[model samples]
Target chain A: MSVTAAKGFTAAGVAAGIKESGGEDLALVVNNGPRRAAAGVFTANRVKAAPVLWSQQVLKGGAVSAVVLNSGGANACTGPLGFQDTHATAEQAASVLGLGAGEIAVCSTGLIGTRLPMDRLLPGVEEAAGRLSEYGGEKAALAIKTTDTVHKTAVVRGSGGWTVGGMAKGAGMLAPSLATMLVVLTTDADLDSAALDGALRDASRTTFERIDSDGCLSTNDTVLLLASGAAEVVPDGTEFTEAVRTVCDDLAQQLIRDAEGASKDIRIEVRNAASEDDAVEVGRSVARSNLLKCAVHGEDPNWGRVLSAIGTTGAVFEPDRLGVAVNGVWVCRNGSVGEDRDKVDMRYREVGITVDLAAGPESAVIWTNDLTADYVHENSAYSS
Target chain B: MSVTAAKGFTAAGVAAGIKESGGEDLALVVNNGPRRAAAGVFTANRVKAAPVLWSQQVLKGGAVSAVVLNSGGANACTGPLGFQDTHATAEQAASVLGLGAGEIAVCSTGLIGTRLPMDRLLPGVEEAAGRLSEYGGEKAALAIKTTDTVHKTAVVRGSGGWTVGGMAKGAGMLAPSLATMLVVLTTDADLDSAALDGALRDASRTTFERIDSDGCLSTNDTVLLLASGAAEVVPDGTEFTEAVRTVCDDLAQQLIRDAEGASKDIRIEVRNAASEDDAVEVGRSVARSNLLKCAVHGEDPNWGRVLSAIGTTGAVFEPDRLGVAVNGVWVCRNGSVGEDRDKVDMRYREVGITVDLAAGPESAVIWTNDLTADYVHENSAYSS
Candidate 1:
């Protein structure tokens, strides 16, 4: 139970011919109750998908009765006709659910620059609406996968009998600003749209925006949070926010673990920077270094590449004052060789890199994967 | 004849036993000049190698008598002792050549975080000095190879008896702010240090700074232009500058062609931008996308990846007004499907990508290489 883990939510997943492999490519989640408060975040990329543009407008009204998502085509870079198709999709969903089109949000994922198979998609929406069930959350999670090896879901319960649950799908192209992925979260708490918006932004700012797998930003990334108020418990704002953050953090970790062609999950922790922004900038710079990533893949404990990466950023740090550690061994101290690199064991799948800027008290964590030949193979033949 | 192609330059390459493979690892180029006027550029990376820091200070005086380069060890991140080693190398060369230590520049490239073998390196410097010959440029070029498949050299003759020639060595970590390479250009034209400085800056700004092989900036990149004034000809300033530019451009192209594990040489041209800066920003963004590079390697006309990259920049462009052409075929027009993608042919080693922002009249071109599985293999085990 993903979205349906909370009360007042029903979901369904249906097979549509949109996917050439005939996989389940359509999903629907409905909020059936006393409140329809909602909030959303979209890809920061200027060239957004048609559904992203449509859903952004729908979310502006601070309410969403239903969300319709599909895989197999991103509906991005399809121009005016694509926007019209998205509108038609929302209209079809609204007609079946007896709700206004403005209350329906739409999402899409898959190959970019292709038109969706509306012929199958529109009818599949009706089928999905007919099959809506409170226990259909698992199916809904399974329907929105493109290259993900497994679907991701997380749940957190509040002390006051409220809960937050979410599902996310992403395998690659995960970078900052926001990971290139789709996420939907549901909560059965008595909260207004503003409260949901604040909680979602705060949670996503630190969770979805920290994992950078390949540094490629996508055109169809979206995250939405819908509240139904079925539990009728007005929990403390701080507690609600913490619950939402916990769920988002769990989903983010799951996405990183399932990243495309990744063999080792690397955690880059930047500490002792002058500010949080500096820490983040340094962490991201280190995370994006293909050379450093490859070194991590080989488990060479190459700290020089880390220093080289850190030097490229404008973050506040002194070259001579910097320190680096691989795993638990301090391989570099005061910008020079420190402990024995051979002492660091990298035989495990999880690799930790700690960078000490030695500037101040701020820190940031960034998750990434090592570069491998499998990654090159996966991306090279993806479109073919 | 590379550096020796110009007058009044003697060079030699010697195997210093510093390399485990017993390859030639030391090179020396001396300017036997009536004028020792010179100009140099170093990597912008703040965490610079010891040799880069020493050479930077030497070039500040606008005069250089000789340049000593080593390929077995970068001597980076080795703390205070690394700087002392570089100073010692320069001092040994100066003692042999009977010049001030301040006039001897040093450059080193190889595994980072390692110290040079001063015992062998000091002896090799005297040997290189003794063997310096007018025909030693080719040997000097061959000595600077770390992972380069082939040595690179270029020459351009001015109209009035002046000549410009150079040698460059780099195969990876090539990115802007300057490609991660070491270049030494020799000119026999009668020009002052200020003239050589202006010409070298103008030439490298357009040539070496525009080729981004793998988007990794190294800590030990350096480019130097030395004027000997042996031709006794005050060639036309414009002609001399053009000659220098031509040689630098040729070397830059060779670096891209020999990029590590690259299969296709991609030329990305961003046109009709709001400014030249915007064009460069867009071109670099697209050139650095591993997804697009992999697509190019697979010979897939994935214009959508190009557009997605452009959207991530802050450049001025309307989403629908964008256009992309792969291999002279306009596969995406007005940000949507245009002519048939099947019309595009990409069976050769050269791939061309033209992105029309359609926002203004400015344009810029960037050269890069396609990503391949071999790249991952080479970098993963580079140090080990």
Candidate 2:
């Protein structure tokens, strides 16, 4: 269950004819709300897509009635015309749903530098609105996939029957500051925009923001949260936040598992840092090292590459005090070779690496994918 | 002609049995000098290799009689033992060349965290010294190759009958801050260590330090200059600097052209920046973009990927004021589609990308390579 798992939210997916393959490529979700509270976090990329720019302004109103998304064209680098297309799409959705255009949020995916096929997308929005239903969550999830091999959805039930659900689509161009993906969450818990913002931020910080699949940030990344207050249950802030985090974590894991052409889902945990930020900085450095990723793919447990990556970071650590473990084997200690690398088994699809800074008490974990021939094959053959 | 193309240098290469392939893996270059002034620069990586640390100390003496380098093991992360190995290699070279131990420099490449085979290496130093000749420059260049398919060398005859010649070897793990490579330059100009340092630093700023092949900086990157003053030519500082720059530019181009598994050598030129530093930053940001590199490999002029890479940089620029060109075709103008993309061609091995910031008058160029399946194949099959 995705958005429809929560009460007061209706969703639909439709074939927009924007995708040349003739599959479902448009999704619409509407909140039938008593309290229309909403919050959103968008890509930090200065070069944002058309929908991203429009949705950022719409999110400032602190209320959202619906969201329209398509997966055929990203509508980035199309200049003023792209922004106009996004505005018109939102206006079209507003007219059909009898809502204000400013209250509608829009998200887009697929190839960048191309304008959306407005002729096909506008009519498809109307078709999606006509088919909106509580059981359409799975279809909506399926419609937003570009290079994704599987659709992602997560759900959690909170106190007093309150529910949180989310759907996300991303396969590559994953980096910090949101990466290249779109996410939407719906909740039936009674909460204000302030609570939604706080919960959403907290959930994303340790989940979506910590993954680096390919170390390439996208211009269209977006995460949105909407509360309809239809469950009529005033859930505690802590419980609601945890529920949101659970869904985000699930989605993040799914993204990593399905990262394009990735043979190994690598978990990089950096511990004993001077600060939490230092831990993240060190973790991201290792996560982005192509050398380490290749070593993981080869099951070589080459911890020297890990040390080199750590050296690039501005983290507090003595060179000789650093330690590295691969697949639970401490292959390096005191920055020197320690255990036998052959003892580290990486035959599975998941690779675990832990870097000990031996400096302080802070820690962080970052998820990434290994560099494989398949990753290069998939990325090199296509433009998206 | 390589390092020995200069008037006062002799070189030799010998098989040290350090490489599993049983190829030549040890090199010796000696200066028959009237003046023995020397200058050196090493990897900026905080996790420096043992040879780098030792050579840094040796260069501080402003004199060098010879250099010993091995190509099968990078003496990094081996702790004190690695440092001892480097020191021993230098001492062995000094003994063979009849020079003081403190007057020798050392360098090493290949896999990290492994101690050199001192038993084989120390003996090989004497063997190489016995075979040293003015025509052994190419042999020394060949001995330094790791995964490189070629041996790089460049020579420039300068004003007043002086000459500058060099050799470099790097195929992978290449990035800014020197890359995973070893370079040696020799000159017969009558110059002090201070003059050589000034010219070497100025030449490298726009050459070796501006390339980003895979964005993995190695701990063993080094560039050293030895001035023997045997030509009896007191070359002008400006002329000497120009000759050094010529050699550096030639070697840098060779490195990019021969970058491991790369099908496209990409030149990223960032122009119209507020400052030279900003231009370099922006150029490097685009050069390191895997997405854009993959696009270039696909022969797709996807300027949107270029804009996305630029957005990640802190260089001064407005999104609406940016323009991008691929292969001299202006596909994007003022942050929007400018010309028909179908008009562009990308069938060549060399790809050129120019990003116009429209901010000011400064510019910089960074050389890089496209990501390919062959690259992944080479990097993932074994640890290097």
Candidate 3:
């Protein structure tokens, strides 16, 4: 419950009235002090949301003191008017917090195309700003969700006061390489923008981009990291970077856990790939496979679907080099159908399938949800 | 119904006793010579079935006269033993017809792992050979089905006496660049093996390769085109190829119409790409999107899903260069949300979406089925 437990940040969440449900949908967080160095990551999708556009430009200055976020509308594909709204929102937060407009980042997520309801949103920003406290991290996590049923937050403590705390939200429209999930991380540890930016990218490679159940990347995907220099010590190289990465990985798993209509959270691990990309490609191919998802949903260990999904990856490998295991049981080996397929079970809410290429030693893992009747029912009627 | 109507072949379909139902599960087709030319197309999946392995070798020789197919057990992943089964099947057919084993080919599709029930199959094969007729095309087509609910056949008559007639069966395990589909074509045209090969490749490029729904390429996919030379006339180059391609397109549509558990057949066309590959990459990207498929199933004109799928194609493009039309109604333009989103309806079984890249004049089309709850049920309990 304490943001300061991991060092340098205070956060707060407030009911913004921006959401129809009147649930908490706005948050503000601050990084007090000496080294306000920060780095930000934005969705690679070309159809950037208005907030992503504004924040990308703001982060170019290499530091940020506070962030303001609103949930309920993506403020994307709304033309030039959306850009204006995004800027005004950031400016209002900057002025109220007695900071430069260019020093405060912004993000928004929810339904796409609708303009921000500034009448209700502007006042909510003031409430969030007033509630900012060192113990407000949990509330901040609750304010960034759309279809998520639970809040997601993670904290990693390192040597000294160096710490990494992060939170994210997304369920549907999720694919890695920037899932619709939005994330914000703050640390008291001092680090250069280049170092933080590099670390964020490296962390995202396996964390955010590896969950491709629905294969849809959101326009508003963003993750920002702020280093407040509040921590007296900054661990070097792998030590601090790994700590930051652990937080991202933990939060990513939480998002997968909340995937829409998901009855099972499946961890698809691909081992012995010729390369990490190959391993990831193979894993993503299976993760995004609707047929394979159905197999998992039925508690049917249908590995043929698994092999079929792997065959789609353009990676070079003889079929005989493949091996697959489900729930710690080998179902295929030496490049042929394994005899123990019937022995595998998947009656639980969590399933794991380990695919071994047996061609190389590298490995990768992707998180996904099963394709269930409810997933079909929910998405089919979503827009209606 | 006459395979000889295309001029060069005879066909027969009989109960192979391979299927427990005792239905017709074996088919035999022979090229009546003169045009003993064969051109073959197989699945692109690296993990090919035993028949795929045999056919790949057969095509290398360029001279094939007959094909024997069964539909009770897919000779795949049975390992080296699987290859032996295919060889034995082909040799038996060759011996019964007084031909060399090299002149015969084999294809099978059904439950994986379970070996073919040959006690009943050997006699079924001889019975099928004895029943061979110049007019058994329909039966041959029907015998190769696994889960397909209907028979698909097409005939195209060109200038002079040349004609192309064929059959195909594919319902599930579908993705393109070969899904789990089988196609056999017989023609009386006097084209050489090279020309026949060229036409089949061109036809497959725009036909079988375009049906990428589940993104699960099957191991047993095969397409064989045989010229029997019964027709004295022979067409060459683009014109002949175009005729061959049209028949393929027609049968491909049939496959889509009968895709497993599909209620809607969706065509995603991408235009004005930087290159044809780029366009195809984008189109295929949309076809494989489970979210889009679910939306189509629900009759939801969710253009956001369309944009998100295209964004992941890795094809470089300006956001504003993109436009989307669902059922001929523009739902998005200039990368901004379109006003007609509420107007595009996908209630019908045939739904079309045109995605304009505006990058260049290259274009590609992908045919796919909308994902539904029934699809999940069908595949999940396939083993049951």
Please say which candidate is ahead in TM-score: 2 or 3. 2
Report the CA-based lDDT of candidate 3 relative to the real structure: 0.80
Question: Of models 1 and 3, which has the larger DockQ?
Answer: 1
lDDT of each: 0.90, 0.89, 0.80
Question: Ten consecutive residues with minimal summed lDDT in candidate 2 chain A?
Answer: A171-180
**Tens-digit lDDT track for model 1 on A200-254?**
9998888888888888888988899999999999989999999999998899898
DockQ score for candidate 2: 0.71
lDDT of 3 at B210: 82
Candidate 3, residue A213: lDDT: 59
**Count of clashing pairs, candidate 1:** 0
Candidate topping DockQ: 1
Worst 10 residues of 3 chain B by lDDT: B171-180
Candidate 2 wrong stretches, greater than 4 Å: A172-179, B172-179
Off by over 4 Å in 3: A2-7, A172-179, B2-4, B172-179
